[model samples]
Target: MMKLSMLCCPLLLALPLLAQAIDAGPASPQQQETEGWLLLQSRNLAASPQPQTATPTERELALQRWLKKYRYEIPDFYDPDAGGKVEVKK
Candidate 1:
């Protein structure tokens, strides 16, 4: 019983590493499509500013609104050129 338990422990420890290896494949077509969509949305949001006198909070709010609108198809990272870290809320 003790020998069997020791053997199983090694197998268990290797399982997670094996799983990670399998997960590390090239991006699929679907992933590419989604990333493209996110880049577009981020760019659009960054380009269009709020009203001339809008406060920083308002601008961030506006961006968040757009993000929520496109959350489903958008990736976590947006295009930097569109606007990187313009108004990040803690």
Candidate 2:
């Protein structure tokens, strides 16, 4: 009984590690944001490769507004207009 318990203990401890080993592959930006708080759980239900468009959360929207208004002279990704596609409506 002691031997059986020891063997089972190792298998149980390894179970979560084995789960993490499965290839989730690459995740897209949209898939990274989700209704669930955890991205990992959401990614499991997400259709891979193709990304679904996700609406920005309130906090994200606020951050974008702040960056656009107070970015000073810094350029590139921090400057939304650098992409020539960001249209932030006032």
Candidate 3:
């Protein structure tokens, strides 16, 4: 019983090491290529595109669109006439 326990102790310790050596198989080439392309495209898009000058009115409209999209809840003290005062009431 002592000899058997000693032999089984080493095998039990090695079980986890053996399990980790199993290969799940190589990743598909298409999946790899798609990931590479996405990474490249994201990098290219992140670089500033050709800067196009916009009129003052167009700029204000763009800002308004951004504010609306973000749902900026302004407070009572926020006077639109007193510049862009963004107040949030908790």
Candidate 4:
């Protein structure tokens, strides 16, 4: 009888702790990526917010495109219809 009491004591104590809980939690994504573009300004405080006259360079365009692919392409990361075969869209 002593052995039975000891075996059940821990579980009995834990039962009450489990009773007081909330529901409806959102599941987190397994893979997540955050991407953004940053512009560095010269120490000339007067040059704040450079005029948009100049267009992005070729390399800059490529980098921005690459960053957009990961940032805006949500389906590629968390596709519900991928059926266990998640494809990484380039």
Candidate 5:
């Protein structure tokens, strides 16, 4: 019938698009965050690397002093058992 053919024609054309939309739904928050970090890292890597210096610059020294004076100590509690237990020497 012409009506059945017309109805199926539009649906056949749209089925693939509907399937794509369902399959490629919105990215998860963590996936989006990881993608953002990956983009940032790629940009940083693409830039020319700065030369390392034996001595700190005045700006670096000043920043270090400020951090030493005001920065709160970050607790080092991440992956405490990562490498298994270490034997302590007396």
Candidate 6:
């Protein structure tokens, strides 16, 4: 019984190693399609132009309107630039 247990123990340990050796080759068709879709999406995202966002002046004006609507007192230190000259780089 002792000798049988020793032999069986090694065989049981080797079974998992043998299972891992079996290769399931290439990815499935669904997996390949999913990968291709992801690649296309990434490429499209890279190629697309950035959406138009609010400028500093527009943001400031929005904030001023919000403050007025809420009836919140503007702090004395809060100096807003109303139509300030913005330097544009050539």
Return the top candidate by TM-score.
Answer: 6
Clashing pairs in 6: none
Model 6 TM-score on a 0 to 1 scale:
0.38
Q: Please, what are the lDDT tens digits per residue for candidate 4 over residues 4-50?
A: 99989998999998896655543434222111111223334446466
Off by over 4 Å in 1: 21-31, 45-90
- TM-score of each model, in listed order: 0.36, 0.24, 0.34, 0.22, 0.29, 0.38
What is the C-alpha lDDT profile of model 3 across 1-90, one tens digit per residue? Answer: 999999999999999888766456437888778887788888886455788799999999999998786686657786768676689999
Most accurate candidate by lDDT? 3
Better of 3 and 6 by TM-score: 6
Give lDDT for model 3: 0.81
Error of 1 at 67 (Å): 23
Off by over 4 Å in 5: 1-7, 16-26, 45-90
Q: What local distance difference test score does each model get?
A: 0.79, 0.70, 0.81, 0.61, 0.76, 0.80
lDDT of each residue in 1-90, candidate 5, tens digit only? 999999999999998888644456337988878887788888886454777555568778878888896676666787766669889999
Which residue pairs show collisions in model 1?
none
Residue range with the least summed lDDT across 10 consecutive positions in model 4: 31-40
- lDDT tens readout by residue for model 2, 1-90: 999999999999999888756457446666555434366566675456787665679779878988897767655557555567767999
Clash totals for all candidate models? 0, 0, 0, 0, 0, 0
Q: What is the lDDT of residue 27 in candidate 4?
A: 40
For candidate 2, the lDDT comes to: 0.70
User: Candidate 4's error at 36, in angstroms?
Assistant: 37
lDDT of 4: 0.61
